[model samples]
Target chain A: MSSTRSGGRSAIVRARVLAAASDLVTTKGPQNVTIPEIAQRAGVAASSLYRRWGDVGALLLEMAAERLAQKFPLPDEGSIEGDLRCWTEKIVLGLNSTEEPIFFRILLAAGDVAPEKRIKALAPRREQLQAMLERGRARGERTPTVEDLVDHLLAPLYMRALVGLPVNEALAKHLVERLLNTPP
Target chain B: MSSTRSGGRSAIVRARVLAAASDLVTTKGPQNVTIPEIAQRAGVAASSLYRRWGDVGALLLEMAAERLAQKFPLPDEGSIEGDLRCWTEKIVLGLNSTEEPIFFRILLAAGDVAPEKRIKALAPRREQLQAMLERGRARGERTPTVEDLVDHLLAPLYMRALVGLPVNEALAKHLVERLLNTPP
Candidate 1:
């Protein structure tokens, strides 16, 4: 009955629900996805999901924010160029693969509850980018700001993918090259 | 019914429906707004709206696309720098306006029926950019590609606004400067 005693069980339920929600959103598309369906798939109570996340959009924001962190951990390649290049490529792949529009849709679809939640989703990635840039600076290399990365590297790929245009390693490589070569 | 008479009447219906959809989407969030509601607001039959648009997603795409064309006609300031800056500023305002999240949400939410529909939605905008760039090129103003404009100018503002970040004229001016200054 203790709150601490139930923490482990609570964590398991959270993971299962998020995984189910992610699977459904990517495979079936978010429009086709639902809370009852996610609860059924996760083997949890629909009431519990409602009580925790409140709605499908909230659940998706959490799931996507988590997936972004887990799936695209920053690459630790020695040089900043190498690090950013690897990270950007992995992101382009994720954005273009099974996750495609769903990942993008969830990120872009946040409403009034979203700015706060959306910040939670993107804040970590922003930190990761800043850390990478700092490493490059420490290595006697000048690095662009986080906003620069978002503008030149990540934003293009995401916007392209969101708009259903061609996006790939070639485009990713070009973006990184452009981002790095341009003077700060 | 002759196709010509129906064509003018059909044009009227489309204008009314899109205007109604845009108003509803901005006032009531996309999820809260529905095709039936759009039809009722437009003074059209729900069945007719369904027959024409097929679904809410399709309807939103068309409405947003038409709005894009009507609301944000490209500017002509006799120079690329002036034209692009003016145009980017206008877009930042629109994206940050009442449409805010909805303009972005609708654009980012397209799925299976989207690519062709999506291209139709964005292609005119692309051409307009190309024409602007060509004008600059004719004046020997050395311009960035349409891709550059998207990546540097449009994408960042869109991604930032889409993610609920602060986007304003200052930021839009910065993007235009970067896009124009970055060399080939």
Candidate 2:
């Protein structure tokens, strides 16, 4: 009973910390948020924060992975084009979120600093996307490979984000049309 | 005569400083390279460095712009598919360059810090890509838009670089074929 209680407590702590970090990112921007502030906001000790995540960068990576995993809900649109359009629109909207660009910039910086850890952190989201594509393939839809998804779908959204370009619905539709070979 | 001599000296100083910055990026990596060190290596005063480039991030941006300007030479391989294939292969090779990834990460971090300046720095490369696409269109090829190029060509290369994915010749060929509707 005590072991179960401790496990439950640990889970609560994890959620609280991540929530606090996300809140700070939304409010003050990712570049401005700090570990001490996150700990204070989460009502956890700074040592606990450090122990759980070595630094703010690691914490941001964890937070990003979580956000990314939750962000891309699989679309059940009947056609491949419909599914892709829905998926692209959702992704574009996510990338254009006010807090998201900063969060992604932090994640990219984290990837530069600790690439292996970043890759590990992103594994859940990758799997999620992979599963969505596999489902499309299983449905007899002509799905692009994971690489194509990254290239044709995800890359444009990110490039626009990084370069401060607009991520609009039209761009999403264009990508879907291009990938599906449908007329614009 | 004096003004012309000063202009010549200024150009030489620009060359030396950029060379020093590039060498430092290659040797010590971009994150570790400092403005003072770059100035020292270039035999310029710290004040001169500041007056010209402002900071290490600014200097890195300038360096990146210069590098990007020279990197993507438009390929004219008779057919659109052949040209795009050649172009994508060159881009993959450039992104895979040992020095280039570090340079790009630094630029991305700089974008986080000073986005407007980063965008301005990237404008030249955007124009270069635009001109290439327009040239393809002039040749009666169904060239993708600047946005499409960003999404289909540039985004994947950068995503691979940022996320530690394999950016190879095969991926380049696939992107070209997919874009041009040519048989794989």
The CAPRI quality class of candidate 1 comes to medium
Tens digit of per-residue lDDT, candidate 2, span B1-184: 9999999999999999989998998888676788889989999998998887667887887777778688645776765677677878877887766544555666676653355666676777778767777777888977777766667777888887666577799888876665566221
Q: Work out the TM-score per prediction.
A: 0.75, 0.67
Candidate 1 structure quality by residue, lDDT tens digits, B71-95: 6778889999899889888887777
Question: How well is each residue in A8-108 modelled by candidate 2, as lDDT tens digits?
Answer: 99999999999999888888767678889999999999998888777788888788788867864668777667777888887887776654465567666
| Model 1 C-alpha lDDT per residue in residues A42-63, reported as the tens digit of each score | 9999999899877788788778
TM-score of chain A of 2: 0.77
Please tell me which predicted candidate would have the highest DockQ against the true structure: 1
lDDT (0-100) at residue B126 of candidate 2?
A: 75
The ten-residue window of minimal lDDT in model 2 chain B covers B175-184
Clashing pairs in 1: none
Which lDDT value does model 2 have at B140?
A: 91
